[model samples]
Target: MSLDAEFERVSMPLENPFTISRGTQTAAENVVVRVTDEAGMTGVGGAAPSSHYGETADTVEAVMPDLLDAVERVGDPHALHAIESELRAVVEGNPAARCAVSIAVHDLAAKRLGVPLHRLWGLDPSDAPKTSFTIGLDDTDRVREKAADAVEAGHSVLKIKLGTVRDRELVDAVREAAPDARLRVDANEAWTPKEAVRKAEWLADRDVEFVEQPVPAENPEGLRYVYERSELPVAADESCVTAADVPAIADRCDIANLKLMKTGGLLEARRAIAAARAHGLEVMCGCMVESNASIAAAAQLAPLLDYADLDGSLLLAEDPYAGINLSDGEIRLAEQDRAGTGARPAEE
Candidate 1:
């Protein structure tokens, strides 16, 4: 059966300004893709572009028409690799755009087979770990409030954003508010190697589980320097982009945070996971601030990861799609009876 594809731009407001070390976003700019087979089944996917990765809403919009055209030419949605190669030939470095098509194809294939994506992948939903709710960079009071809210919402893990002079104060405030919540921090490449080492030691004392991207992505030596001296586990978010980048930094960091937006989609994400494991680096599945469409697609890979930061949809003031359910930080995937990614447009 032939396939038809289409895309639309979407903007979802955040519950509050989501400030990371790089910048702040009051809303997320995303592109949603839908693919329909001649059989009349439709599958949905989305991309949340990041400027840090050289992708913006404008870039995504510019590349999507050709990308979708490439997808439409593919004869089989199940033949993901063939479709991926065709799309890659159409454009370069637009991972988010590639991701939108890759996921839409996967969703369509799963739907055609009449199985939920996780089931089709032979994964057990119960094995999927609980996701961590993020507390973005903010004033100490707002940090405390966000931490408190996460704890009250039954989230067992809280990933805090750091990389400022107030880093220590923010961690202290969050700990005070949610004493029992597992704490993790992402510096977003804001620290020097020496600063990262110092902060890691300080954070270890505060019971921080791990530190993410403490040093800049471009500085593998800085990452290695901190990893060698720090008492806490160091995770490479910015440092690791694709599976090929994994082996080079595998010895420098304890964990690799893989996001669909970075790897281009689930196919590459799975490959990156295997690559990380091959190099003895643990894996964390993460996402950008996106709607449920993309978050749900990322959620399908949760069973294969050691950690999950798939709360992007939860950060939205309103999500137009629904798929995964987070109860007390636990990730509950859509039922097996549902087809494709099991994420559909919200019913008003």
Candidate 2:
């Protein structure tokens, strides 16, 4: 295999506003990668920007120039592996940029091997997995409306964003409107330990599925406290990014929200599941406001996870590709046989 390849970035703009803990995100763009071998095979890859992972877009945009320069310099896709040790060196450990580079390289490698992404990860490509549709923080009435719309739109389970003064109200309203809907809540580090427990108890009264990161991650001891007292199953978000963070917080919560942007990429994220399961923690594959490229990468990890929260793409105004077929909250595989979250060509 020869090394010479070309690199470029394609931005996938979102169609609508994605509301969350941070704020309402109006648009999203992903950096795309193409790898070419001397024998005439090309692989496609995509990456999300940092805003979703709590980093600035400028940071992610800045990271690509250096990463692409190095990739082009390496020449061969196989040689790209040699340059990977320097992956985090350029992105400074930003999961979005690194995730993009990682998958781009995988797409190149998968095409070389002539196999689909799931096969590379030892999973069946045809199995359909259901993902949870999100209900962002809104008016109690609007929360109920969004919840109803999600259910009517084919979502069996829903994840609602909470963690402000309206937390209890929104949860109660949603439960009232969608009584039969399975639900989960994310506080996004909006409450204190004492307050989180109180909120957990409140959520339990509404028969909510579970509360995620009700309190700050800085004090996992509070999570343990709430877990011990509340009837709800506690899940960790923004707290369990790395495998190293798993052991310390695994006992404190029952589930973890794993995002490619946070865990770095599919390779590392694949490793996190085993670590979480060993510590008796479930996994929730989630994302920031990104295109199908980002979600496609996370979809491979969804089968290994107990809960799937990969709805970031559906919230977009327009999707770039038919990356994953999501229906009734279930993700239908796209090019599942290809390696590293089989992403189809962007131009297609």
Best-fitting candidate, measured by TM-score? 1
In model 1, which regions exceed 4 Å deviation?
334-337
TM per model? Answer: 0.98, 0.89
Residue-wise lDDT of candidate 2 within 1-348, one digit each (tens)? 454434445555554455667687667766665666677676655666665456555666677777767676666665544556567665566677777777777767766777666666677645545888888877777788878888888898888888678777888888877888888888888778788777777677777888888777778788788778767898888788877789888778888777778877666787788888888887777777666666776776655767888887788767665466664687766445445456665477
- The backbone clash count of each candidate, in order, is 0, 15
- Model 2: lDDT to the true structure: 0.72
C-alpha RMSD in Å of predicted model 2 compared with the true structure: 2.7
Candidate 1 lDDT trough over 10 residues, lowest sum: 333-342
Overall lDDT per candidate, in order of appearance: 0.90, 0.72
Clash count, candidate 2 = 15
